[model samples]
Target: MNKTILLNNRPNGKPQESDFKFTDSDIPVVNNGEVLLKTKYVSVDPYMRGRMSDAESYIEPFQLNKPINSGIIAEVIESKNDSFTKGDFVSGMLDWKEQQTHNGKDLLKVDADKAPLSAYLGILGMTGLTAYHGLTEIGKPKEGETIVVSGAAGAVGSTVGQIGKILGCRVIGIAGSDEKVDMLKSKYGFDAAINYKTTEDMTKAIADATPKGVDVYYDNVGGTISDAVHANINRFGRIVVCGAISLYNSTSLPTGPRIEPILIKKSVLMQGFIVNNFSDKFPEGMDQLSQWLKAGKLDFSETIVEGFDNIPNAFLDLFEGKNKGKMIVKV
Candidate 1:
């Protein structure tokens, strides 16, 4: 039987277990030019929260009763396509199902021997590509400059901080928990880390951390945290707007301090982007990330939840900030 998870309802605010439905169906059959895939790992991300809503966005919203898809790493258990063979591993945006079949279009073969299958969903996949492109293309940190990353302990944020350090920038990270903050500095080499949850004054904390001022702000969690960052932005600063997990679940439009004055005064460059924006340069990003990973200049972390039934819970955990780095479900 193939266990599939679908969008049961459009989440009213924060998603609940009731929003996802699990059903059993016959395993899919592979036709000529198709490969049968067995789910190995599933990635649960905060950006997916936007896709759950029916609002117009960069990507289409998930249709009700249809399979909810995200980044996935799967094994080719059976293959009728010459491009793939049994035991081959592939990574792509696949459905949240135990097993499925594909016609090999857009699917990229991955090697487990080089890195674990789950790595493709995080460091070696879209997550890493997002970090690489956003920082290099928009943030553009220079040597002796200061870089601040919101959601610093997440997959993309942590990698962004590491890359900043590699490029000779002083990096500061903001995370929810003290443990995550510590990981950012000690494990990922962030120069400083602030626990936004415990800090009384975010703006002051950011100011204190970066005495030189923030040249680049890699924003992942927008809201008041972003407002605080704007308070300390430097002249000609660059802001790479990524995910906004803090406001993803809000039923009403969020109100915050306007950034127009700050942007105009500082001549700051702010841009929002998704991984696909850098699709043409994925090979370049992958090469740099892999080289850094193999050379010990870069590292990654994962919170792996075991069991196919636990996928929804694992995804829900993202809003609670319960996972460090990448959150992946091992099926």
Candidate 2:
């Protein structure tokens, strides 16, 4: 039997285990031009929360009682397609099922010898590309400038901070705990990291951390933390709005301190973008990230949860800050 998960319900706010339904069916058979795939690693990202809702967005919402899909690494156990062979590993947006069949249109072949199969779902995949493109294209950091990252311990945020450091910027990170803060500085090479949960005056904390003023703000968590960063943003600064995990679960519209006045006064440039916006440059970004990884200049972290049944809980753990970097489930 092939195990599968479906969107049991549209989550009201924070997603619970009940929102996902587990079921089993026969393994799909390989037909001409199709390949049978066995899931290897599944990725859980904060952005997926938005897709759980029925509201229209950049991507279509998962239909009620239908399978939920995300980035997945799978092995071609049986192949009928000429482009794929048995034993080949691939990565693509795939449904949450232990086994499935596809025509192999969007799947990209990945080499385990080059990088771990799981890394293809993270540091070498969309997560890494999001960080690379968002920073270089929107944040546009310069040497000697200070770059601040919110959600600094998670997959994209952590990568954003490291990329900022590579660009010669002083990187400051805002995280939920001291442990994550230390990991930011010691593991990812962030210049400074603040535990926002412990800090009382966030604006003051940001101001102190970036004495030279914040030139680029890579925002992953929005809300008060972002407001604080804006308060310390320098003239002609740039803000890359990659995500708003802090506000993803809000039942209603979120209100915060006005940012227009600050933006106008400082001539700041703030832009929100998705990874697909720079799809044309993915090869370039991936090449650079791979080169950095090979040179030992780039490092990645992961909180791997074993078993396919744990995928739902692992996803919920993202909101609770349970993972240090990319969260992956080994199936």
Candidate 3:
């Protein structure tokens, strides 16, 4: 039997374990050109919170009473296609199940020897691609500039900060906890880190860290921290608005910063991006990230919960900032 997590009810705010139900079903069989996959790991991202709501967004809402969907790393148990064989490792958008069937064309075989299978759900997957495109295409970070990233301890934010360092820019990370702040500096090599929870004045912390002013802001959590960064932006600074994890489960609308005037005065450019926009450049981005990983210039981390039944809790943790790096469920 295959176990799956089903959305039992829509969440009003922070999701509780009761809102989801675990069910057991027969393992799906593969047809021609299809592969049967046994899931190894599943990614839990902040963006999934938006999907929980029926409200309109870039992606379609998850249907009620249906198995939750996410990116998963799986090992092929059976294959009907010549391109893939039994025991092959692969990654793709798959249902939240212990085992499932997928078309071989839709699944990308993973090179386990090059990187861990979990990396496909994080550093080499959508999260890593998002950081690469958001920082380069939207933020346009330059050498000697200062770049600020929110949600700094998570998958995308950590990648953004390290890329900024590689680009010869000073990187500042904003996290929710002191432990995350410490990891940002010690593990990710962030130039500076601010624990937003302890800091009374966000604007002061950012100003003190980047005396030259922020040249780029990679916003993963849009709220007070983003407003604070906006207040200290330098001339011609660029801001990339990515996921707003801070506002995802908010019962009320998050207040915006009264810094529109600053945007004009500093000639700042702020833009939001969805990584799919750069799908054409994915190969190029992957090649570069792979090279960096091989050269030991890039690092990645994952907070893995062991069980397919734990997917909901893993996703809920993102809203509470409970993860230090990429959150993954080991199925």
TM-score, prediction 3: 0.97
Measured against the true structure, the TM-scores of the candidates, in listed sequence, are 0.99, 0.99, 0.97
> Could you tell which candidate, 1 or 3, scores higher by lDDT?
1
Flag clash pairs in model 1: none
Evaluated at residue 53, the lDDT of candidate 3 is: 91
| Per-model lDDT | 0.95, 0.95, 0.89
Q: Sort the predicted structures by lDDT, highest score first.
A: 2, 1, 3
- Candidate 3 lDDT at 113 equals 92
Q: Give one digit per residue, the lDDT tens place, for model 3 in 1-331.
A: 7788888999998888887888999888789988888989999888888898999999998888998888989999999988899999998988888888877767888998988899998999999999998899888888999999998999999999999999999999999888999899999899999999999999999999999999999999888888899989999999899988778889888667577798789898988889999999999899889898888989998898987767888888877778878999887
**Candidate 1 residue spans exceeding 4 A from truth:** none
Give the TM-score comparing model 1 with the true structure, all chains together: 0.99
Clashes of each: 0, 0, 0
Q: What lDDT would candidate 3 get against the real structure?
A: 0.89
Per-residue CA lDDT of model 2 for 3-27, tens digit only, reads 9999999999999999999999987
Where model 2 places Cα greater than 4 Å from the true spot, the runs are none
